[model samples]
Target: MENDQQQKLISELVFLIEKGNAHVSMEDAVAGLPANMRTVIPENLPYSIWQLIEHIRIAQKDILDFCVSEDHEKLAWPDDYWTEPVEHIDDQTWENALNEIKQERQRFFDLLQDEKTDLFSPIEWGDGQTILCEAMLIADHNAYHTAEIVVIRRMLGCWR
Candidate 1:
């Protein structure tokens, strides 16, 4: 039987991952963004909204892979996680990124929802990190970057 603490932890983690209790959700952040605006770098900002989105997707996918894949090779920090600056991003590219994010987020959510998953057990390939740790890390990381995307949208006057 799951204890109260374990159940509460799982519940809170799922809520944070899916709904973004205090900050904007990923779906809210990306919704209604124009294709042309995705690649636009707002003044003084280093990364465009699309770049941040891609970075989040890449990083989340990497973490998910690390959690599941015994043979997963870690990518070089910052470089492999980010994309080169582009002049413009087409609708298809933007849609693809969003789709990938949605899929990966669902994957993580499923893991958390699995009754058999040992959230506290260390992953064999990870450095003594549990699934609970990875789930929280992804939630926190996504929330951080999702807020950045919202800020960029506000700067561009694109967020509605």
Candidate 2:
């Protein structure tokens, strides 16, 4: 559990991005709330609102795994198959989605002390010199779509 500056930066980046995701998670986790309002999409798209979450979640997991194991092939996603799909999920699907996202986010942060690797390994599709770069990328990815969902929710009168 070393508290180095680099680890702090990674943790902070993860926190910032996840905070953005959490802002919309309340509305995003609303099951079948509305196709546009809900974060998880129920169809085949590069990233549905939920898909974005899943994509971000899996991306973080995959990247961390890739960095530690050098199993970058584990990062190989199918053609046009980036986000994990969840169509016609049950009534409580929203809860599951929320839990999954939160768990993955926490798990990514938990690696701070245990995994001593430099956080700068380039993740798939990452432009930065380290995982911290992609950390922001994932956060920005969620932020972008979460904003989209927020707009949709507003249009649906679900805005606070």
Candidate with top lDDT is 1
lDDT tens string, model 1, 100-160? 9889988887887787788988998777999999998999999999999999999999888
Clashes of each: 0, 4
What local distance difference test score does each model get? Answer: 0.88, 0.55
Q: Any runs in candidate 2 off by more than 4 Å, and if so which?
A: 1-4, 21-48, 72-87, 121-129
- Global lDDT of model 1: 0.88
lDDT of 2 by residue, 135-157 (tens): 56556766766676565545556
Instruction: Name the 10 consecutive residues with the lowest summed lDDT in model 2.
Output: 36-45
TM for candidate 2 is 0.60
- Give the worst 10-residue stretch by lDDT in candidate 1: 1-10
